[model samples]
Target chain A: MTQQISTMTATETVIQAENVNIYYGSNLAVRNVFLDIPPRQITAFIGPSGCGKSTILRCFNRLNDLIEGFRLQGRITYHNHNLYAKDIDPVSVRRHIGMVFQKPNPFPKTIYDNVAYGPRVNNYEGNLDELVESSLRRAALWDEVKDKLGENGFSLSGGQQQRLSIARTIAVDPEVLLMDEPCSALDPIATLKIEELMKDLKEKYTIIIVTHNMQQAARVSDMTAFFNAEATAEQGGKVGYLVEFDETTKIFTQPSQEATQDYVSGRFG
Target chain B: MIPAAQPQKSVDLGDLKIDHSSRRSLFTIAMTILASACMLLTLIPLIAVLTYVFLQGFRRFNLPLLTQLPPPPGLTEGGIANAILGTLIVVGIAAIISVPFGVLAAVFLAEFGKGNPLARWVRFATNVLSGVPSIVAGVFAYGLLVKTGLTGYSAIAGGVALSVLMLPTIIRTTDEALQIVPKEVRMASVGLGASNYQTILKIVLPAAVPSIITGVTLAIARAAGETAPLIFTALNSSFWPGGVLEPISSLSVLVYNFATVPYEPQKQLAWAGALILVLMVLMTSIAARLATRQKTY
Candidate 1:
């Protein structure tokens, strides 16, 4: 019924994946992923366990390149620059596109140093103290840590450490932020705080979060992508494929695919 | 009295409870006693040795015990300070030679060398090296350094021997410590765009530092106590160890040399040297154990 609404407006598509397939050694891990991630939007990848949702999320910044046998047959472009092109340095790509892991994997440094690490390594010439303060403030962690910035990063509680990791990622002034279930290791209250922080973050950065919790995707993401696996004899096991991609509200309400319909209704993942 | 027939009152099967006691039995008590007895049995020799050394050594303790050289035969007035200084200098040199190679080898095995044939071979060599007699290490160093004309029966030669003995221990322990550093920590660093070198140097190595220090300290202690390696390499000198290139008298070697002599004063000095050596090793090992208690996270 909508006449002239393009799925992704011209200015919106910051990252576009064209026919993506990932492999680990000989196993086709994920297949046939065609998606466009809008800039300054919180996009969530929601799926069941071991569906390679995390695997696909890692590919956005070529984080998957670190894996021993990881291979991708896909054209993933960041603002139309081929990320996998031989000339494109993966380290610089990762520098511009930061990531927060599922665990609160802070470096064994003081809280201040943890946040300052990225900026330092990338040779950020700006005032470090101000940057650390502002980043921590943005992550809702400054007030709690201001007096004890020299303490080890692990001295903080689980949620605080997760926030510290986010601060660390943002301190580098990245164009895109990748969060792999950043709240899974946190308590419910902490998860709520992270979700709220995600909402505020979209004002300045594009964020792609991979989440196992369906409600989290519904609550925070502007758009949602669902992935599912199907057994294939040729592949010799189940390999993940993107099942649905749409506005979060629509995907949760009136999804076009039967699998999406079943998933949102909690019938099956 | 008539158990089977009487319990037909349904036995209240749901009300019946199985024993969940965690209490120890007679067998457990007996085993604990046996283990303690076995431990005490082994400790008997240790206590006897320590007590004997202390009894003989304490009577000769004076300011000169740390300030003067050993006395001539029949004279019981001086101390083995030359040997003490010699031991420190030789062990220090060994640590200097061993630590860098051990730490680097460990880093390679833990980071880049996992499952690689060359690393596996090196690790295997280290294991074999750990098992080799310290005297053999001394003989090898004697042939390589002393006979080969690099340095003859010198402290540096002794250090090389001790380094050979210490390298395997340091490498194995450091490798184990590095392996325990969570992969996520490394991934976190690399994910932040740090290169492999940066991630390992700034993150992985620092995280593994405490445990590595413990291993390095223990390796030093072990090298400090080694007597056989020094015999073929360092030999013995009554004078203060001049430098790494000169013949050195380590406490272990001095004890070996004195204990075999027929003189009474020399025997007493040997007892004192033995005491100092044991205490030095004991202190270093305790410090290492404490360092190991620091959390890797």
Candidate 2:
């Protein structure tokens, strides 16, 4: 399943997670994780279900804060700024770090309004029409939707709606794009389209994706982090942790950990 | 060590049997007839009321009925136009007062204060308030406004009383509508850097507008038919309504005041007023249906 893609050698880190642990109420969810994300490259988190890949991805932009009793320990720094600092606003954090969800959730609005909503909320004083057009172009949806800007967003197919969501996210001009299983709901052809889109998006913004599809991780990501879950003493409770993080090609071809080998070889039960 | 061999069982693939029982068919026919009888029984009262109102009211349902005030005891020469106008004024004022407060309270309950202790208390209060008797609302208004001599027995007091009746329905429906919006839609807005207020105002509220309209219209229809509250608050007048601050008449109160009189002409006017009130409620229901059919998402 390994597909060769151009890889960039590590430069200075754009985001760093140090000794991170996440919890919900009294129970631990993900424990002891350290990882660095570099700028202008695609980093993929791949693991089985309940491995906290999505949870860790959400932490990068503080999206997990929406859940009740969600707590994060240790430091997450973005470009040397402590993301968890008492004064840092999660609202502003999300403005700089945009997200795409697992399902294609477009606002019940016109396609043009859907893309323009971010800029309007941020009080953008430019020609909004230009910004929406360029964002749609970057997300590879402009040509398909150029003629019908006033159509409701839900009128489009699932893949087009997802692309419109991506357009809506990028319309805010974020520095980082965090995608949570963006293609899990799409068919094979739609999934391939989004994979190609990710490869194109990485040249401008740092991309972090969490996916259960290992072949997708192998095909498009420059770096890959593998996470695995272990059972707790409490019956049926599992806590996720980082198993290995390396260059995607290296991780897929010659991983250092036995668990990584089992997972990549599809031997995991 | 191998055990003895086992014999293979032959597979049976017989045709499926279908039931065609005459007794079951007869029982089904009997049940259908019984259900139809119950349904017809339920419609009897409604049809009788409508037919009786139409037969009696049409005798007096002319142009003058919509343009003139009610005549003296046995004259039978005027209409209940003042009562119609007063009903509109009172119900309009009630909608204006209740809609904003109810929707804002619903937003608080559904979005900001979802699991808070205050929200639970507010929800409980709303349910109790809805169950309070209509006559009690009228008496409360009498004590609060008429007895206090702030507005006396005026249209303003009547409007306030009707608004009290409308608030619970508006709050309950709008809260349920706001909650029916998918959680992911809110997340999408938040993920795009929109503030909580911005998300609610632009995204969540718009999605709930159709249901909100349906709720507000139903509340208005209910408020229009209420007579007990207006009896103490509005205090029916013979003359046309001069202003909202003055005593006013409504179709419900006019019907109540005139229906039991010994004069034949006044009783006919009461039947005509009842017919108009029924038409108003029917029109409001149709408007609500049309509103709910609008494409929100």
Candidate 3:
């Protein structure tokens, strides 16, 4: 573990999960998993449907707590603090670890208000105009929308709405950003734009994105974690497990594991 | 390259073409005729009611009839001003009592309820209350308010009964409206670090405003036309009500009284009052529609 930590000295680890397992009622959705997400770098989780990539991403911000009967057995530490500690507030965790969903979910409000909502709710007592402007700029949407901040968010095109959702997330100045298939609903051009924005955003915030698109994982991520499902003896059903985690270049080029090679090379999911 | 496969002769059969086009036209024509017949059926009753009301009530449509109070048994020199005023006051008070509680209840059911047993029971009770007869609500209010001498035979008692009648409507409407607010919006607010109360107030309530207003307006309109409850609670006072605790006569009660009278003039006044009541309801409904015209998204 010391050697592994020292090998990535330039980028520090921000989130560390040890033998994390998640269950919804009696059914286990995610098997024991271990992962370390580095600071100021993008980490992409790639897998087929129901491979627990999104579930793991949701666990980081405790979004899965919204589900009934959801329980977890694990130690997930953020900045050396246990995220699921009894005294820690999920609301505050979510505020610092913002999320962008697969679908573009801008609030039913004006573009300006949508961007300003986070700051206002969290009581960020700074210059709001500056905050909204900077956040929108970081999201790569300020130029196109600068003149029409008062217009309704739904008036924007799909790409713009997704960007607006990103802007809304960043407006709170979160330390870590989690995107659950943020560009799945976007066209190729929009996807490219968001990809570029993600590259830029990683300089300031750690990003963990769950994407089914393997090419996107290879192109944008510094490290890639490939996940797959394996049959469980007790449940007689497939449960998601992390198959491999390595540098993105190595994962795509010369993966150590046969499953990672097959997944990246498109032989199988 | 292989020669292109010859077209299948059977696939382009003329009989199939004719059958398809003929069936398509038949279906189209059938749908058109059905829609037209439905529209005509809906319009006929509306036109007939309007024509009948206008013809019967036009003779008594004068400024004096609107401004003056209803005449006594032998006299023929008055309007329904007091009754109209009383109706407005009673409905306004009922609306004041019902809207906040109903909206709050709906918010709880939609946002925090999550199928909890208490929320489910509250919802079930609201549904049952909605099905309860308005007169029964009047009886309930009379038992609670009049029997206890809280505000015996007063506008306050009438408003309380009407508010009960309106509560179910407002709750159901607000519930449906809040339910219609996309779940993503609430999640987004919660994601933004806003508390549950703040999310309901800033996000859920605003998104549901139009539907809530429509429901509240419909409740008010329905409450304005209620006479049985008003009769039991507000009783019929010839003089104008001085306060919420004083008994008042509403338009419906005045119409009921005048229509049952032996005089010809009173009967005409009843028709006039009916026309006015219909007009007021129509105006309110139209205003509500206009107010909610803004696009929700």
Candidate 4:
């Protein structure tokens, strides 16, 4: 399928992927992806499992660099800076674009330390106590965790831990927040709370999420990109491609592609 | 003709029958007895050794024994204080020598060089080194350090010998400890913009500290009781240990020397020294247990 451009103005786009091909060694994992994520809005990547949504999401912050054989072709740009260029350090790139993983993985340290870790590593020259407090407040976790900030992060409940992870990610003051299925491991009530938090966060940070839940994409995202995988003869066995990209309401109500329609209406994936 | 098979809709709890004397029960009882017998068999040697040592050593295991120096062959009122201090100094030096090198090598194996050719050869070398006898380590250290006149029959040479024996255990245990840390925890660190080195130093190493401490303690325990290495390296000193450059008297070496003498008093003191060495090793093992029991992550 051809690339589908959304109605959003290009001037507002904070991240752009142009003709990107992701590979693990010689095997192509995702082929020819083009996406433009606008600032201060939620962009959700919706797909079935093994469709490379998470893989592409990791590319934004160059988190894929940790995998031994991962490689990316073409370009991913954050505000016209070529992220894969020779001089660009992945560590610094990560400082500007942070990530929240599917499973909430807070450090084994105290809650305060967990939130302060990123800033400390980045050498943030500010009042650390205030930063931790604001980050926790912005994550909607301050009230629940404030009294026990000295406790180990592992002591918290699953939902609160996930919130703590969010607080930790934001504490570094990243311009973009990449969440890979942030609420998948959470209960419905916790998921709803996170959805509300995402709605609140979109006002400040450029939020890009990869989700398996269609309703979550519908409820929380401003733009939605639908991806689908096809069987391939390559060693990787399957290759994912973007099937459709548009406003969330349009994609949910009347998608241009049959696959998107089938996926959204519960006919197929 | 086959009767119509009727599927029971629900279980009747009141009518359920359980056989109390089935073959399974008999097998379970037989296995339980065998396991208990095996456990008791294992405990016998430990209890017997402790009981015998306590009985023989209690005669000389008095305050004077810990405070006074080793007396002449016929005298009976002397202490093994010099031996105790020598053992502590030698073992402490061995720990200092082995711990840093072992941990760094383990870090290389577990993190930076995993699955690489160099790491494979390192692991192979560590395994072979661990299998090498403690006597061989003593000889190697004697040839390298003591015979070279770098440190002649001194505590430093003994430390080098014991450290050679200690290194492989520390490296292997620390590697295993680092390997068992959750992958997600590492990913979380990396995702938070930490460089690989920073992640290892700040997050990974701290999380593995408890297990690493356990390994070091066990290594120290093994080194403290080593008599063969000290025989070749730190040869016995009649007086108190002068310095690291001079010969020293450890509890194990004292035990080996006095146990074979013709005098009965020296022989009694030897039993007391053996008991002290055993107690030290036992305490170290208990410390290792407590270290591992702590919640590290």
Candidate 5:
């Protein structure tokens, strides 16, 4: 019930969730929650396994609609539009808000085709070569894959495939980028490269990332939200609840809540 | 008391044991040999038939036998050229009619259908259709086409019959091929903002091309040797077909007719026709295998 609006006037809020609760059939996964994500800033959602951080992230674009028996009692707004509105289309919502999965899931296609897929589907009729090049450049992958555009996407190294997937997503020119553990399957060097890319991408797009690594959250995020699970008496089940949301520096250095402090200091998940 | 102080003398030991498992392994070897012999016995008839056909037909493998039309019963100077052409035309027509429909049906079942009840029913019906005998399909086509006076006993009718026989096989095989395409590729396409249709067209189909080709080739091979369907629909004509509406003679029907004749030359011609059919089927199967060469990097 805390309606703590931000005092900062210049930052534009791009996404907001109000009293959100997600369920799979009768199983309640995420409890009541409210969150505000600002444009051109990296917001990281970190929590222990099964705390529903990724589930909440998927709710932003309604990706959870693909699952059977998945339902939500909440309002998630992207800019001025309610994403779950009856008149809205999930495909259009996805085109505007792209997602990068945990694993590098590049299509079994040529590198060029993989990048071109998104643009073509979105009916982008501009200069394709330039679009692909710019998207790959923005993803920091153009230099590595420029010579091998004809090669299969699966032929790339795991790290490179992840970057190619990012390039594919950016080719559609989505306004918001949601990454779910984008670097968990990568090595340290690949992780560093992605972190750097995230920093550059935030200048143009709003980003919300769910990561397990606390250090990654501290290093890349501008705003951090800590989520924890609490047992619900009515349902006889554990439901994830937001513990704290603040400036990343304050959350890591001087948290307002004891739970956030415990989570950040590695005392408890 | 050191009563009967234990004897300190070393006792003699028996010789070391030798493993007898290897000796007992001979029984397994004997059983395996017997099983292999039984398998070989089962294959004897197939080998003997092939060998007999080859021995009798090799002498007829001349240019004239392939290029000339069937001669009068007393003459031995004709070939199976018209029959081959007729077979090619009918099979080509059948393929044209069936391949696209079959592949599309497969795409519906494998990609768009997912868990749709209608797709499941269609799939089940297709399995049932595949199990139906080729002669039954021929009879159905005869009843539908001949009874309607739509060029009774014509090449088109034959093509329709063959297509019906080929449809279920093509659909089932293509569905299996599309199913084998890794879900990761589909997910990647969807994640990139591609619509379901786009994902299927770009990602799912391409990855399954090899298997699809394999399936189509096998179907074609099966269609080439089908005689019952052609007998009922195309009937048998001594002359070449002028158009789709005219009856035509295929190699299978030609072989069947020639094999039943009471002449030495005709029997020889039948053997030659059989040899050509086997060769064509073999080449097709080989081509299919070649097309599916796995590419890994």
Candidate 6:
């Protein structure tokens, strides 16, 4: 749909994954997934619950490293650098690629301090006031929160807190943003606001979202990857795998794969 | 012959309301009454003890009771000033020794060692230590600090014993406070590229500070009232503490000794000492609650 605006011009591929397989201890949760994420665009992973959509997104910034049994066999390239190389530090990768969680999780702090937490940790040396103001403004939360920056972040409504969370991410000047079901915890209005914010943010940062809401993927994503789970033979357990990935319009309108088509049409049992 | 089904009467299901009086259970009433009786039983003793103690002790409340040394066998003009100072000194040192150790140990358990076998072992050890008697702690400290002739029968020795008593409670409560902090908050900090240590120091510690302080204060109050531990470690002196290295006159030991004396004045002095100790503990507890009650943001 945006072929007229910027697709005609060359844009660098920001991230690429090859032969990705995720395992939690002995369980092979996902296998043989290949994908590419583009810069200054929004890509979404859509799947049923427990289909490893979140697992894949977490792999981007290496958040899954926090889990005890989590491991992945894959080569993910970011900015032409090996993301999981021996010398590559996941911490720095996370600094460059920030994340927003499923829920609106602001710190137990004032709005101003919540936004400033990111920059302060990374040793931000510029005018912090300006950074805080601009970050909140960019996230479309400044006007609402400008009056009481000292109030607790939780005092804001759910949507506002989500925006505050976004403001915190962007303050660190991350090149990419990963969101794992950011709107699932929100009401329709709050979800709509976050969708709008995602679109606005894509002009400056590459955005990736995981959503169970197919309509959400159709609405905000430029590209969508649909994942499905099948019963494993060993213990009658289910394992998730990617089925189809394409332009959002194509996936929603006329998916080449039967599973994608059924999912998009709300006909999958 | 084929039989047709008869039409049934239309029930107004939406308007249906059962009479609750008929559904009420006598068993529920009995259980509720039993629970309330148990609760009252618990409260009655607490209230009775507190009331009796205050009534007996507050009568001796006066400026001299707090400001001067214990009077002679027949005279009742002096106070438990040295004992009060000694109690404060012992508890203060104990808190200073234990708070940092306990809080850091809790942080290690709650943050880095979560669900690890070592963490489980640490938690089990903490529970076991809490169950160890305070007099046993005094015995342990006496053997370590006094029997070894390091600082024999001194306030420092008493502090070491009190620290052992306070350590497990502080660690357990601090761990509880840190655990109450949602995992998502820690993830948020780490996702911001803060190292685990940084996340713990900047985010987790600040959020747990109020509860940590409360735990430490409660431990201090409990340590202040312990008499057996003081008898074992500090061993009680009649005069003011010469230094932290010397034997000190603590309120609990004074009460224990003077309460058994034949002299009326000594007994009265013991009562006054008990009252002062209770007030100190009460004030510490109140301060702790107030500290935790305030909203951080």
The C-alpha lDDT values of all candidates are 0.89, 0.92, 0.87, 0.91, 0.86, 0.87
Per-residue lDDT of model 2, residues A75-190, tens digit only: 99999899999999988999999999999999999999999999999999999999999999999999999999999999999999999999999999999999999999999999
Candidate 2 ranges with C-alpha deviation above 4 Å: A1-9, B1-33, B295-297
Q: For candidate 6, give the DockQ.
A: 0.61
TM values, all candidates: 0.94, 0.93, 0.91, 0.95, 0.88, 0.92
The superposed Cα distance between candidate 6 and the true structure at residue A16, in angstroms, equals: 0.6
Residue range B1-297, candidate 1, lDDT tens digits: 224445548453432443334354566778889999999999999999889888988877778888999988788788899999999999998999999999999999989996699998999999999999999999999999999989998999999999999999899988998888998888788878899999889998999898898999999999999999999899999998788888999999999989999999898888889889988999999999899888575
| Residue A228, model 4, lDDT | 91
Give me the displacement of residue A181 in model 6, in angstroms.
1.1
lDDT of 5 by residue, B1-297 (tens): 233445784443322343346655777878889999999998999899889888888988899877788888887778888888899989988999899999999999997797699999999999999898999989988999976897788889999999998899889988998888766566556766677887888778877888788788888999999999999898877776678888998999999999999988888888899999888898889988986775221
The native-contact fractions of the candidates, in order shown, are 0.67, 0.78, 0.57, 0.65, 0.59, 0.65
Model 1: which docking level applies?
Answer: medium
lDDT of 4 by residue, B163-241 (tens): 9999999999999999888887888788888989989998899889889999999999999999998998999887888
Off by over 4 Å in 5: A1-11, A228-241, A250-269, B1-50, B294-297
**Per-residue lDDT of model 2, residues B1-297, tens digit only:** 222343563443332333446677778889999999999999999999999998988888889999999998878789999999999999998899999999999999999886699999999999999999998889998999999999999999999999999999999999999998988899889988888999999999999999999999999999999999999899999889999999999999999999989999999999999999999999999999999997464
Clashing residue pairs in candidate 4 are none
DockQ of structure 5: 0.51
List the DockQ of the predictions in order: 0.76, 0.74, 0.60, 0.74, 0.51, 0.61
Order of quality (TM-score): 4, 1, 2, 6, 3, 5
Which scores greater on TM-score, model 2 or model 5?
Answer: 2
- lDDT (tens digit, per residue) of candidate 3 on B1-297: 223444653343334334535877899889999999999999999999988888888888989777888788777868777888888998998999999999999989987899599999999999999999999989998999987998898998999999999999999989998998877677777777777788888888888898889899989888888988888898877876789888898889888988998998889888888888888899889877975786374
Cα-lDDT of candidate 2: 0.92
The 10-residue segment of model 5 chain B with minimum total lDDT is B11-20
Question: Which digits, one per residue and each the tens of the lDDT, describe model 6 over residues B1-297?
Answer: 222333573444532444444435566777899999999999998888778778878887888877888886777678889999999999988988999999999999998886699999999999999999899999999999999999998999999999999999999989999988888888889999898898888888888888888899899989999998889788888787799999998999999999999998888788878878888899989989987895342
DockQ of candidate 2 (2 decimals): 0.74
